[model samples]
Target: MTDNPLSQAEYDAVTDAAAHWCMRLHANDCTVEERLAFEQWHDAHPLHAFEYEYEYEAMLEIWDVAGDLPRPETVAPMVRAKPATPWRTFGIAAAVCAMALPLAAYSGWNLGWLPDSYQHFEANDNVRQVTLSDGSQVELNLGSELTFSNYKDQRRITLKKGEAFFSVSHDTRHPFIVKAAEGRIRVTGTKFNVWMYEDQVRVNLIEGSVLVSSNDAVAGDGLRLEPAMQASYRRGDFTPRISQTYDNDNSLAWRSGKLVLDDLALTDALPLINRYLSKPVMVADNSTGSIRIGGIYNIKELNNLVASLPKVLPVYLTRNKDGNPVLNSIPQQAPKS
Candidate 1:
């Protein structure tokens, strides 16, 4: 309803609130209830209603900017940050233009590198199990961010951010490679997970070993992580530590909407909780943030998780200003020590 929008200031206010509501709605974890409430709230005032619709429409346009382009129906969501500029242009240009991305990138790739086409995957909010031209299966985890790049000889899977698991169907010709946070993971055939957030990068080998090195090969030295081994790499160095290992039980359960908090304290579980929901989660105090908790909870069912938390911690979950979630853990006063 830009026809008669709200005052500039009013429009900004409503639109900003609406954007936040969108995130809240997303984190609502399920159903259109939040969206419905938002609609009602937006329509409460003429100006607010108009601004809401205008912003909503803008969102649709930005999303459909790649109008009618063939894209994977569901993909692991990426952080709500800007996608590469180059990909956006390609999206608009390729829509319905008899577009055919190299299907080989989805099939059997051999000794050679991935083509430039794979560099830009149009993904969304679901795990993308991609078969490289070499027959390697690369499963991109939820919200895991990555890009594709094609070199003359080696196919590259660049974990721009987030995480992914590779269950490579071995091919001797082409060595499977994963790139993340200025580090490189290379393996011939095996299962492994690469998690990257900012400079925190880790590689967990599930089945086979991978030769990992800092992307800055000139200055960075990585190492081989054998099965059940994990390493944390930052600033181009791997903090030598045996990675956590799991068997028959669900590994990477997040992909299945399950959060396995293994004997994790409330404090320890905070990070995973924050990651699952779109909205932010924080502890009110550092002391509370350090509490450990353990148990498994379905990612979509937060109430169960919340109700169970109290039994496991000396804290309460409270809302902060601006509606962010904060944990407030209290303990019995110690007798005059």
Candidate 2:
């Protein structure tokens, strides 16, 4: 392996070429002519071999994490055919790369030629904090899933589910966009919160400004929100209802491990509360879902809250056959029997 470092452009070209060769050589439909061509390319220069080895190693790592790999016998011939070299000792790298090619494409590797890279993040049981390449910050609430891609001219985030808070770094050249469900929140730099439910998306702006628009919305045809403002729209709705003023403290209570349910329906509130629980709370029927409640509760004391639900609301908590907590409307007493 050559120890010399190539320039950025040169390194990118080599890696791009190596990635293409890696894919072509391992393809099920790869031809004899293509295999010969790959060998020639690999031996053309030491840098080519070095980069190919690196790319092969990366693909193997991805497959290792995924716990799926091609059989060693299927890939042994490719390595044994090559002349003995420091970079050609691995017998399974090419097979692993070929097996994971589809995943690589889905993950935005695109044969290593795409300028933008993609990342996925999830907060399964606790909040997660992430810093982007451009210095922007994100905080994902429990059970939230986020996908990110940074292009030359844009920083995009897809909120696949649940909620997240963002503190974006100022960058006029590259707009920051957050996509949740069918809606998009666009800004140059700002602090905001986004919550994505099954049928709705809510945006709360804490600093700077943002444009809340739908996927099919026309230019300048979206709602603009300033500090202390909020907006929400259901899936497929292009127009969002904007609230000029909102309760900042209540809106952001989750960051402090608290939930502030101010007149929110039980159905609407359970989703937020269940994010902190191992077993989610479910409504027994639609009648129980319609009961509105208000209170501030610590997320850590979820069991206690479940026990006290009957005291504050006209609903009682029971356990299902599987031991999952279920909320049901209280049975009214008979006037005469």
Candidate 3:
């Protein structure tokens, strides 16, 4: 064992780093460069390797308690240490004591453990409001789904679909994170709205600040976003863009039962509009999808917007057999006889 005496803060940082390394090692596709980086990190400090080994042993102990499961064949064999009293062996006594009876069963040294229970919020036709365990409030927009899980050191939220506005409470010790689509948003205290439309992810900062990054935490320096700014990333794109002057209020208009589109393409705007109703508005083809539309219309006046489409552009609107709106381009009219 290493002989370094660590301060509480230093210990937490080392363990967090160890957790990240352990997670990387478990990945089946961990590459040569990653292994080399791990080696370099381990060699940088004696305590680094020691923390990793301790974490690995704790994981193995969990597997042993789970059943006599075999260890991952890739890792080098560790000399078995005699087990001590239950939690003391892993140095997780403080964490175990912090958990309630039910939560203690689910809490583990692994990085991915969720507490005993999480709050699941899903919205259909109407928007929903949720207050988390840490006093953070979320305005879940229509057709959205998310799960909120709290741990001793972090508040984690996974947005499965659609959009939500987050009002995060201040907790410097515990960061607030939202995982959506292909990236994540990390914050200490902030107000922001995140929208996931298919493979695209957009985060608009209303106040305070946040760090936005791709799912790969080690890949690149994450983007820092401040008030009145927006960051957008799409799948397969090399990099995301941060807009200094995006009209964020337009996106949040849904909270007031209004639909606001500001020169947005028909293809992009349709999905957001569709979220307000059960029956959707579909574009007939790619040609009609390129038309730019800008307006502020009440969601309750969807029929009026559909009726007025032909007046604004060369498009024909019709309903499918299921009573869903289908938009198509208007064919040329013949000369009058």
| TM-scores of the candidates in the order shown | 0.57, 0.64, 0.61
- Candidate 2 TM-score, C-alpha based: 0.64
lDDT score for residue 291 of model 1: 78
Lowest lDDT block of 10, candidate 2 = 76-85
Model 3 / residue 211 / CA error / Å? 1.1
lDDT on C-alpha atoms for all candidate structures: 0.59, 0.73, 0.73
lDDT of 1 at 152: 47
Q: Which tens-of-lDDT digit does each residue in 203-290 have in candidate 1? A: 7788878887765555444577878777767755533344556574454775676778777655556656655455556788778877
lDDT of 3 by residue, 256-333 (tens): 877889888899888767655567788888989988888888875675777788899789889988888888988779
For TM-score, candidate 1 versus 3, the one ahead is 3
Model 3: clashing residue pairs? none
Per-residue lDDT value at 152 in model 2: 62
Deviation from truth (RMSD, Å), model 1: 14.6
Any runs in candidate 2 off by more than 4 Å, and if so which? 1-22, 25-117, 217-221, 247-249, 277-279, 301-304, 318-325, 334-337
Model 3 stretches with alpha carbons more than 4 Å out: 1-112, 217-221, 246-249, 277-280, 300-312, 318-325, 332-337
Worst 10 residues of 3 by lDDT: 92-101
